[model samples]
Target: MSPLELHTRALELAAGVIGTVQPEQLVLPTPCSGWDLRRLLEHMVGQQRGFAAAARGAAPDPALFRDVPVHGDPAGAFRRSAEELTAAFTSASAGAAEPRLRLPEIRDGEPFRLRHAIGFQLLDTLVHTWDVAAALGVPAGTAAAVDRDEPLAAALLDAAGLVPAGPADRAPGRAFRERHEAADGAGPFDRALALLGRDPAWAPPAR
Candidate 1:
């Protein structure tokens, strides 16, 4: 899958959650432990902006919106943010040197490649999409076979070595625990998010 395709899919998955957020039901819990619908969508928007900034050779502003919507038009706002990220990733020219992802919590002193940025984005979108689904009882991960996705998951999972397992990968030999934990390992959603810069337990910071 190309980066653009991944970006588009990421947006599609994110969009799938908009209706689930509901107009006044923003406080509903999502698959991510601590975050409600509003908070999770905020984080999603922040990620899109931050990733795009990085692609533009700028510092990642994860907190680009320090005080974003806790409750508002969840669907429209999130869709716009998704579009912004898709455009950013698609238009930016980082050349051979991929942008270096400096996510302090996930890992320290690690510089990620450019293509990996798209991969990372895909990972987060895919997992969070499932989170939204799981919390709202929506179905996901039916797009492709796990065997084919393992390679893509492997590259992103390379970063997982430094972090502790999130709720998704706590058990061994499980569906999402990763079949390749020895640096060459890979798996479905949760493992992929671990490889990217998100917490499997990703919750919103306290208000």
Candidate 2:
């Protein structure tokens, strides 16, 4: 996909997540351990800013933003951050090499190219939507989690290859199996969710 298309989808996905944050639900628990909804929102806001800075070819400006938890609707703040992220991505690489993109957040040891960055960003945004939906006692659509879209799925699978390979055999309490046991065969989202220790059949939790 073009940077423009990826940027547009990212904005939509971010907005979708932001739309899930309800005022009373700020303190709710989520899939990520040790982070209540508030902390998760704060992290997402900060992370988007961090990536925006990277997209603009700058190191994160720690001096600019405080880490103190802010009170109020997380979705509003998150949406603003999303706007910044879209602008950064579109501006940085819009007409340049979409093929050489790299986001080193997951595994910086080995450099991945453009397809990896786009795919990773899309996948990450999609999962985080589920996280927010869980916190808000809402259901994130299953469609976002499953992509039969061949281009996007192929992109994600390609980026996934860049993850450092583990041993071939599953160890005790392994996070994933070489094959998925889902009745209809695994989807790209299934592989991603499993990689992050989520059961595909489980609904996002509310706590």
Candidate 3:
């Protein structure tokens, strides 16, 4: 699938999960360590805007990294950010050979290829979709969402080999907790989550 298509589907899945978040559940912990449901949503909003800014060839702005406030209507705020993100990517320059993006997290002002940026966003969006669903005590995988994620996982895996293998090989400034090895008979989605440093079996602690 094209990066645009993959990214659209990932955002759709995340929106689905976000739409189901209950007011009382915002405080629940998610699969992402140290992030509660509210924090995760805030991060999602920030990421959407940040990536959208990158697609526009704008320099990274620290202001764009601020978390979205969860007051009033958090879901509405997310929907707005999602729309902006979609618009930015869809309208990107098609003629540019290797579009360059200035990602906020990089700090070094180094530009990355548009496709590469989209791939990282795609991976992050898919994983967080699961994180949101799990925090809500709902199943993250629908047959359709899994179908979309499977191909994305395969693409990421192919790219992973080019990254040096070791603890130091982790994405700059991002530390993955100990990886949970998938069981022998694990399904494609489970294996994919594992490869991305997520435990497929992760759930919120029982209250």
Please report the candidate that would top TM-score against the real structure: 3
Error of 2 at 141 (Å): 1.4
**Which lDDT value does model 1 have at 183?**
29
Q: What C-alpha root-mean-square deviation, in Å, does candidate 1 show against the real structure?
A: 7.2
Runs of candidate 1 exceeding 4 Å displacement: 60-62, 65-67, 93-101, 139-187, 190-207
Could you give the C-alpha RMSD of every candidate to the true structure, in order shown?
7.2, 4.8, 3.0
Worst 10 residues of 3 by lDDT: 156-165
lDDT of 2 at 199: 55
Query: Which 10 consecutive residues of model 2 have the lowest summed lDDT?
Result: 168-177
Candidate lDDT values, in order: 0.56, 0.58, 0.71
Model 2 deviation from the true structure expressed as Cα RMSD, one decimal place: 4.8
Expressed as tens digits, the lDDT of each residue in 1-207 for candidate 1 is 666575575577568666556666666677555677677777767666667666666643435523356357877877777778777776663355455555322333255666666766666665656566555545344223322555544543543343345665445432234333222343454555544333444343444
- Candidate 3 TM-score, true structure as reference: 0.83
Prediction 3 global C-alpha lDDT: 0.71
**Against the correct fold, how does model 1 do in TM-score?**
0.64
Per-residue CA lDDT of candidate 2, range 4-33, in tens?
475456557557667656677777777666
lDDT of 3 by residue, 36-131 (tens): 988988988888888888888788776776677766566787889989988988778465476888866653556777777787777667667777
Model 2 ranges off by over 4 Å? 59-70, 95-104, 108-115, 140-161, 165-186, 201-207
Choose 2 or 3, whichever is better by TM-score.
3
